[model samples]
Target: MIAPAQGGLRVTAVDSLAAGEGIVPGLPIADARALLPYLAVREADPCADAEALARLAGWCGRYSPLVALDGADGLLLDITGCAHLFGGEDILLADLTRRLTGFGLTLRAALADTPAAAWAWAHAGPGGVLPVGVARQALAPLPVAALRLPDGMAAALGRLGLRRIGDLMDLPRAPLTARFGDAVARRLDLVLGRASEPIAPLHQPAPFRRQLAFAEPIGTRGDIDRALEHLLDGLLVDLDQAGQGLRRCEFSVFTVDGGVQRIGIGTARPSRERRHVLRLFAERLEEIDPGFGIEVMTLEAPVAEILPAQQAALEGGPATGEAELARLVDRLQQRLGRHAVVRLEPVDSHIPERAVTLVPALAPPSHRPWMVEQPRPLRLLPSPELIEVTAMVPDDPPLTFRWRTVLHRVAQTEGPERLSPEWWRDRPGTRLRDYYWVEDLEGRRYWLYREGAYGEPRAPRWYMHGLF
Candidate 1:
């Protein structure tokens, strides 16, 4: 690939065929074409390259969630606790190299005690596992460029006959700082493990997670379900020992083709019931599109809560009411949506419309109790509808009313109970309401309210608020 450079279009990259012909990056495209009469070339797209690199980094999540972008052309994976899953560091690196090579990518990989050392090894030294305490030795022969100094720093060092990392190692720190600033010393310290260099991962690894790798890619639903069950078996044991349960969890399918399918579920309450949790996941398992078959499956609990052990029935009877209700809600949410299953909780407000709010089914009960002293209808309308009414007097209960194009005549009346707007919450000019419990001639009862009072500049407007 070629891109516009300082003087002219230059070779930004080359294929193995062109690389054999002495073509390298930074060589002018004119000179490259002269070297090879028919060299196939394409413009280098840095943006597209960066995006593809980011996607590759995302795919690396299967190996470890702590994956970071090293540079435009590289990825950094913190496989501290993840290598064992692929057998060992040797096997893991081999697997990674093989897979990427199969994808038509020319790449190199190395592992060391520090990211800087690993980078140097992969870019300059022999690429493989560099044992602990050998970073200083392994990095010695590598060129000064491996230290990742500012542009021109490496060429400047070479001009002074200091071309290797080992030359700088024996130099006085004060002189080096006075000559090249602290960049040289800082990078050296980082590579030799003298300073800590933390990798900022794309996503933080969850504390509660389990991963299962398949020797051969598996695409069948039964195989996927079995894998999930096995993972949950181990994950739940950890949660049980910790006296905790997960409220939200995710199941990720890492396909062999570098695609990921995720199925997530949330519980109405913190739960560790194996069967109950599995059933919830089963509802959404069909959504998994195992692209060229899945090679890895991971279960992660991003949200968890403390759930103390509960006493069980001696006869091993059915679950308790709360548990059963919670399971029902979980099932509904899994099939429908997280917001589909909810309960009404009372709010600390006097306005009928603001008296209650919708909350998740398992949300903690509100401290404020319901207004039972003042009778409320079994159901309430989302918003009161306006109605036309005829009253014996301006402030008296409605004698007749028309709602939804239907008319009703009042037979019995019980109220004109006045409720004022909350001064702190309601806007100015917000009027008080007079509510009435009236039974229509057909014994159909209705809750009605008047927005304004009598003798006001504008007459009161009646609204049908709820049904009895």
Candidate 2:
């Protein structure tokens, strides 16, 4: 209760004297009473504490979607892509402080390359962003305790007359690692921004969400339209900075009378243009019915991907515009949702027919864009089936064979192209497969193969797999 009561009420500022002025966190109640006669105390509520912490974490979503609770009293925010909204780094800090104060919170915020450096800054030094790439300079004046060093390591450092981060930074790397072990050196490196540290936010990835609460509910088109632009402006900044564009973006309007009007937009290619994107969504916005007054407008990017640079035209000639394609894909996708539009990328496989597969357009293309030696199939077969043969030659196509229940005579034949299964996967389990290409009496061409054995005494079963 000493800490809890002193939470908003500071030690020097308060006149309400409870006992336990000298008592610390781990001290017993009796010792506390002995130190001071009258201790105004209250029972601790663990449940209430946990609930408050959870609520506070959820509330932090307004400032940054990436927020986590560091300890019982501290919060962690990854403001990497979230700053610049309040103007700049300094202005953001001021705005955050002001907002937290409105929620009756005493906050300490820090910006650094690593979570540890930021942590140290928030607790021990001026709570603000250490200018980019210079966390070490700003962290120098902080006490070694800010490194979160173990008690023994801290004691040893203090004895060596090394009380601050500056002292630790001055020592040779070999000697420090030799005396204090790797943990101390690592913690120091992290706080100094020499080592990388990433903050794990409280919530799972929530793709860019922008929301605005109005002073009063708005039912007019002009008001709704104005609010929509305000939300889009902030979202575009984040996307632009990250070098990403939304494949699917949604705008949701929540009404005071429990009504919701949603509008969505999609793009054929990645984009960052504010006016173009707004224009894309304009169609959906025009369709929104403002049955009741809208109290809030939210813009969210549920699906996003890295937008790469594209070439619009060749050096020699003009290229076609995407205005028509974009409008069509967007309308179909919005009406049917994301799954309606599709794209494909090529994949590598050893099997002649197993070379390519269908995949979503948003997925990153294969790392290797070019594969020259191996010839890829012009078309892929779902699965290869075996073919029966009567040819006397070992590597010759069967003169006559049954395929799809129709026995066709081979007017012209090709050599039996023997393709062995890849043995690297498993030497013991691998079996050799032989493939053959044959042309029938008709103009139709087919790919057929026999598995396991070419021929000894046993007859081979045949299957018609694919067409060319």
Candidate 3:
């Protein structure tokens, strides 16, 4: 593969055939083409490589919980006690390599006591399992480049005839520190297990996760659903043991082609009900594409909540009220969108328009109650519409009003409720309102409000706020 370099496009990687024909990384494309005119090349995408590496690290979770990205192209797996799961360390290594190789990946791997030692052996020395306490001896013959020194440090050492790691091992600590700072000594210490290097995984491992590996890859929808059910069964058992229920769940399908497909579902409340969760998953099961065939499946609950057991109804029927409502909301959210299912929550405001706000259906119920001291209109306009009014007196309710080009003659009136503007929210000189419940000759009720009091500097303006 070729990529833009300091001068121009250069070979970033090469295939086995290209390497055999004298093509190598870092060589300018011009020189590479001169060596072989018909050479095939593609641009290198660092971003794609990093993403694939992260996915690979996630796939490695089937082996160990602690799997971290070594660099852009390497992965570090701390399989301390997990090696026995696949028989032994040697067997585990073989299995890992075999699976990755089947995915068409070229890999160089080594298992050593320390991360740095393993890195050095994998990149420079022959890849194999290095026994404990053998890193120092095995790495001594490799060149200083294997130490992963800072840029130009290895070249400088080579010019001085200190090309091998054995040379640096015998050098004085003081002189080495003075010449190349502490980087060389630090790397050496790490390889020798003198210093600590902790691996920070690309993604946090889910506490509640279950995996299934099929002996033969399965591609049919029935097989995929069966695997999902089995994984959910195992995961639910874990959640039950912990006295918790999942709030969000993810199902991942690992295809034989090294591609991963994930499907996700969420609950309005924490739940351990298998049938309900299965129903939710059913909504998006068609999204999973079992490319080639799926060899592994994983189910994980990254978000969970404590849910103590509850008593069932005496009649042996499902509990009503909150549980039923929550399930309905969950289904609606899955069918519609997460934001589509919402409830109007009461806001601490006396203004008709500011009395309530839309909130997610899953949101916790507010303790504050809706204002009901006085009757409210059945339907309130988003904004009050202006109207032309003629009243018998300045302080009295309107005798007749023209709204939307239609005149309504008042048959009766009930209120002149005075409401003051909120001092903290309204600006200075803001107007107060006098609201009224008026009935037209046709028996239609209307909520009318006059902004600005009578006889004020600004003349009172009438508005139609709601219908009842």
Best-performing candidate as measured by TM-score: 1
* Candidate 2 C-alpha lDDT tens digits along 383-445: 654445567675556788875567878877554566677666547745565656668899667
**lDDT string, candidate 3, 8-124, tens digits:** 999999999999999999999999999999999999999999988988987787777689998778999998987886788888899889989988899998999889999998999
TM-score of each: 0.78, 0.47, 0.75
Q: Write the per-residue lDDT of candidate 1 for residues 232-342, one digit (tens) a residue.
A: 998898888888899989899889988777888999789888888999998889899987899998899988899887664443367778878988999999998878888
Better of 1 and 2 by lDDT: 1
For candidate 2, the TM-score is 0.47
lDDT of 1 at 432: 88
lDDT score for candidate 2 against the true structure: 0.68
The number of residue pairs in model 1 that clash at the backbone is 0
RMSD of 1: 4.8
Candidate 2: segments with Cα more than 4 A from true spot? 2-20, 129-134, 206-298, 303-468
